[model samples]
Target: MARATTAHQLHDLGLAAWFGGTLANAVALNKAAAHSGDAASTGAVANEGWDRWTPVNAAAIGAHLIGSVGLLKHDLGRMSVQKGVGSMALAKTAVTIGALGVTAYSRVLGRKVSQHHAVPAADGTTPTASTPPDVAAAQKKLKQLQWAVPALTGAIVAIASYASEQYRPEEVHRGMLQRVLP
Candidate 1:
């Protein structure tokens, strides 16, 4: 068994936070916000939670990106000679880019909604009829984006799992053999 490096630890830990935090907020915080009394309070509650999470989320993303670069650098030699490794890395890169885009966009929408601190809402993403047009629109977008961030991040996790499997001794041996033989 190989020892885990700093990059490996950071990559897994950061991704775990990125995926788990968003899922928990979507599953629990958003819905729970609705129970905070009036429409305005609901929006405030949700915004407060999300706002607090933003800094931590940014840190997690930064750590993940740094770790990803480190891992890719370390794997370059193997990627060049191992069948399927380069393509798999490319796929993971694409998915990671997609996840980053969704996360950024969601944060933008969240800022839009949060700017109007006292804005009315039914829940984190649900806009009450009295919600101002701009805030309501932002909320609507956020509703969809909330799910998207987690889905895309979850995809990254899945791909990472597959990539890990490719690192097994037998798999690596077979992959290297196929690369040289064909």
Candidate 2:
């Protein structure tokens, strides 16, 4: 019970951080960096912000993965017997994989932009007229990917909520009955 509780806490905390931080950055940080007075300063500001967040985000992802493994281990028997648990687990796993892939790709793009910190930029993911072609291309892709990361994470959160509801005592009883009767 303690192990399960810890795993649940870690999973929820890590996921919340990952989702909130990315969304905050996309919604405010990226755009706000442009207010630093110049295109070059904008790039520098955005680079610094994202660079600072990298390690923390990595830790959050690590925690989330560890917790996911712990929770899966704890829930294996429940999943085997419960009607909807296996499907929920499969769906959540798929979403987690998608979120991770998007996050990794976005980080790669971020690095491409950050490496050229002195380069001119309209904002974090927006390129200026004088921005180099390569960095500009990366920024263009990141502009799209920024939203994707959060959206997928948000989907994970939503799915996890649904899965939690499935664990209610009544839900479990009904699901088990359905499994046995049908």
Candidate 3:
């Protein structure tokens, strides 16, 4: 019986950090920023926090990728024999790619908002009473993507859970036998 390795720990921990951080930022940090009253200050505070978290998030993502590769290398034989493993792996990969895309897009939108220092009107002037239509549009997009980051990461966590369940000794033996027999 092979015990789990450091790679698996890294993979799980890194993913947890990535998922939890994204959710925390969306639920808490963003709300706090919005509560600050001044729209420009809200953008500044949120942008600053995200900027500070960027390096840590990058490290977490890198660790998860590295760990995923290591785990895949170690489990290639099991994965080949397991009936559902390949499909689950593929799904996880797709979700990961989507999450990465959403993260990047959110950052781009955040940068645009931060650069303007306030939500600009459609005509490119700052609004006094309400959010400018252009800025509102960007914010709307960013809001969607921001929520998406956590949702995608949460899906990955669920996928990982399924993979873990599939790694049980009985499940592994059954999978291998199914492959050998059929």
- List RMSD in Å for every model shown: 1.5, 0.7, 4.0
lDDT of 2 by residue, 1-182 (tens): 89988988889899999999999999999999999999999999999999999899999988888888988998899887889999999999999999999999999989988898777999999999999999999999999999998899999999889988987999999888988996
Model 3: residues with Cα > 4 Å off, grouped in runs: 1-4, 117-134
TM-score of each: 0.96, 0.98, 0.84
Q: In candidate 3, what are the lDDT values of residues 118-181, reduced to their tens digit?
A: 4423212123347656666667787767789999999999999998988888988887788788
- By lDDT, the better pick of 1 and 3 is 1
Task: Note the clash tally of each candidate.
Answer: 0, 0, 0
lDDT of each: 0.90, 0.92, 0.75
Candidate 3 residue 142 Cα shift, in angstroms, is 0.8
Question: TM-score: which candidate is best?
Answer: 2
Q: Positional deviation of 132 in candidate 2, in angstroms?
A: 1.0
Model 2 clash tally? 0
lDDT, residue 43, model 2: 95
**Candidate 3: Cα lDDT at 20:** 89
Better of 2 and 3 by TM-score: 2
Model 1: weakest 10-residue lDDT segment is 1-10
